[model samples]
Target chain A: MEGDIASIGAGLAAIGSGIAAIGVGNVAGNYLAGALRNPSAAASQTATLFIGLAFAEALGIFSFLVALLLKFA
Target chain B: MATDTHETVVSACLDSHGGAIGMPQLCGEWIPHQIFWLLVALAATFFVMSRIALPRIAAVLAERSGTITNDLAAAEELKNKAAEAEAAYDKALVDARAQAQQIVAEAKAEIQAELDVELAKADAQIAEKAAESEKAIAEIRDGAVKSVTDVAKATTKELVAAMGGTADAKTITAAVTARMKG
Candidate 1:
């Protein structure tokens, strides 16, 4: 039963991580398009883009941690 | 005996396993995996942004900057040219003004010189006319004096001839004296 629960938690974690990744992809795609259109603003926008990517990736990281925790603890 | 003990230990371990088991978890800490994936994603994003996006953007920016600088330099050169042209025009204007003044001065001098020459000529003519008038007056006076002397001499001769016939010395003398006195 514990193993089954752990498996289920791991599966949810994967889904959550996948969803976060999708969000990051969207942000990056939009940033790229905008950068292409207005190259002058790229220097100013790079930091913001990285910050957004970091936040989205943080969520995925949290989900992965939950999966590991459920499995181990 | 060792094989029997190994089997017993394995069975014990399997029996202790939970029924809910579907997958095995490798470790208690998921942070490592999370960090690794996050790093991977960030690296990928940065790579695309730097390699693909940033270089093109920089190139575009550089081109625009170059164009702007070239335009500014051209404008500066044009401005300098215009200023030089203006300076040249001003210099020419000054030269023209000076030349005109010189011409005017020269003309005035020439007019003054002509006037002086005319005045001198008129003065000479007046002096010449005055000398001619004086000469004419002197000649007329001399002619009048000569005519008066000639008339006196002729009258004397006529009187002497008329009183000479059949007259004594005293009578002639008395008659001549009377006539002369009268």
Candidate 2:
């Protein structure tokens, strides 16, 4: 039962990380499109894109913590 | 009874540790595994952002900046062209004004010349009329004097003829002197 729980946690972590990557890719793609349309506003929109990337990356960090908790705790 | 109950609870807590966890604890503490995982995630995020994401963002930003600069340069060029057009328009306006002034001056000069010519012609006509009037007065005085002298001579001849007679020498001599005087 412990092994099964550990494996499930690892799978969930991997899925979370993959979802985060997809979110980052979506943000980058949208930002690139917007930047192409309005080159002048690129500097202003950069902060928003960074914030979006950070939020998506936090989800991966949460998954990594959960995986560690299940493995060691 | 209380001590036995306390011992049972401690044994239960020990059993929960998964094995013989024999370690002298100074201040009761344990390692936090979640914190370690969070640290690893933070490091990975930093690496990925610095190595992959930042470079991509930088490239996009550079391209955008280049485009903006190009647009600004084009706008500046257009502004310069507009300024040049305005200058040309002003120059044309100045030239037109100068040309109009020159034309007005020339017209005024021509009008003055025409007025001068008309005045001189009027003066010449008045002088000619004055000269013709003086000549006419002189001819009328000469005619009146000739008519008066002819009338006086005819009257004296008629009187001498009327007094004529074949008489003595004195009479004849008197008649001859009278005729000579006439």
Candidate 3:
């Protein structure tokens, strides 16, 4: 029963990471669909896609930090 | 010291969410710092994208449009030049045809004048030859008439002697002259 809340938080954090994965997949899938339609414009939009992926990944990282701190500290 | 502060501030709100007090992200002490950094990141991203990247994209689009317009103008100019050249060629062709017709007319007139002169010379030669032939025919007729008169006078005097008639020269001449006259 030690750090039971922390353990659940870690599980939730894992789910958060999964949500981030879904977000990343959505951004990449949509970009790929559009890129296939017009390959000439794909290069210009690549940086924006990377920025979106990074922001979505940041949320998962914050959730992981919270779970780790709750478990260890 | 940092862990103690984190535990103290987060413990107030942690139990309500079924979380432990040791989560640094939930600590009141870290709130301001995280918010400050997040705002900074957001503002920096906004400024960089709006001021640098967006303007660069706009400039690229504008340059493409300008190139398209210039190419269209150049094509139009070439088309106009082609039209002008065609018109010039047509004008030159028409002028050449007119000049050729004028040359042909002048040559025909010159040839006709020469032919007329030759025809006049031929007619004059024909008329002169006809006059000479008529003069020669008149001289031949006059010589034949004089020879016949002399032969008739001699024959009449011979015929008078052969008939046992005495021939007087004066009478025989008178008779032959009268017959010739009749």
Candidate 4:
């Protein structure tokens, strides 16, 4: 109760990081599904899969960064 | 007075305890500093990536694809060569078989001609032997007929003398000849 309202904003921003986790899971899960359906093509698409993971994880990192900024910037 | 004294003693952005008075990230005083460093870092990353990492990756990919294409071409060529070799082998086999058949036919013809010649020689030899045998049989029959005619003439003369009748040799011969002729 004695803390500033920015701490509340920071806590809310962390929720976005958790939401970003859902996006990352969606990307990985879809890739796995496609890979399992066509294993012969999986080897060629590994690079694309890693790129998707990086893009998904970048958003999660951004949300975590915003949370840090809100908390202690 | 307390707030003014606190702001004067400490800096505008820091508390007396050395903590930030507010969000330092949004402070106008440090915006240029952050912007300049951000640009510098981004430029450095772009230069390294564009000049080194990206070109290496592209070259590796190109080389790998080229190698795969070359290998595929080589495999195709080898397959064609194998087919040609097999065709050549089949042709050679056919030629050899034909030559063998021709040799067999030539040998058969030669053997038949030799057999025909041997058969003709044997026939000629058998015909000569048969003719000689027939001539010998005719001479023996002529000798036997002369002997029989002499024996009958002597017996007829003896019989005439026993009967006390004189029979002439010429008459007896004439009668015997007449009877023998029948």
Best candidate (score: DockQ): 3
Which residue pairs of candidate 3 clash?
A: none
As a whole number from 0 to 100, the lDDT of residue B17 in candidate 3 is 45
TM of each candidate vs. truth: 0.34, 0.37, 0.36, 0.41
Of the pair 3 and 4, which is ahead by lDDT? 4
Candidate 1: where are CA atoms >4 Å away?
A1-73, B1-28, B121-182
Kindly list the per-residue Cα lDDT of model 3 for residues B54-165, writing each as its tens digit: 9999999999999999999999999999999999999999999999999999999999999999999999999999999989998888888778877887777677778878
True contacts kept of each: 0.00, 0.00, 0.70, 0.30
Q: Over the stretch B10-108, how does candidate 2's per-residue lDDT look in tens digits?
A: 432143433323331211333344567789999999999999999999999999999999999999999999999999999999999999999999999
- Please give the distance, in angstroms, between residue A10's alpha carbon in candidate 1 and its true position after superposition: 35
What is the C-alpha lDDT profile of model 1 across A1-73, one tens digit per residue? 2457667877787788888889899889999999999999988998999999999899988897787766655
lDDT winner, 1 or 2? 1
Docking quality level of the chain pair in candidate 1:
incorrect
How far is B12's C-alpha from truth in model 3 (Å)?
26
lDDT tens per residue, model 3, A1-73: 4557768877777777778788889989999999999999999999999998899888888777766765655
DockQ, per-model, please? 0.06, 0.03, 0.32, 0.24
Which regions of candidate 2 fall more than 4 Å away from where they truly are? A1-73, B1-32, B125-182
Q: Order the candidates by lDDT, highest first.
A: 4, 3, 1, 2
lDDT of 4 by residue, B1-182 (tens): 34444534355566765567567777677788899999999999999999999999999999999999999999999999999999999999999999999999999999999999999999999999999998899888888887877788888888998899889999988877787787
Candidate 4 scores an iRMS of 2.9
- Candidate with more favorable, higher DockQ: 3 or 4: 3
Error of 1 at B9 (Å): 31
Candidate topping lDDT: 4
Once model 1 is optimally superposed onto the true structure by TM-score, how far is the C-alpha of residue B18 displaced, in angstroms? 24
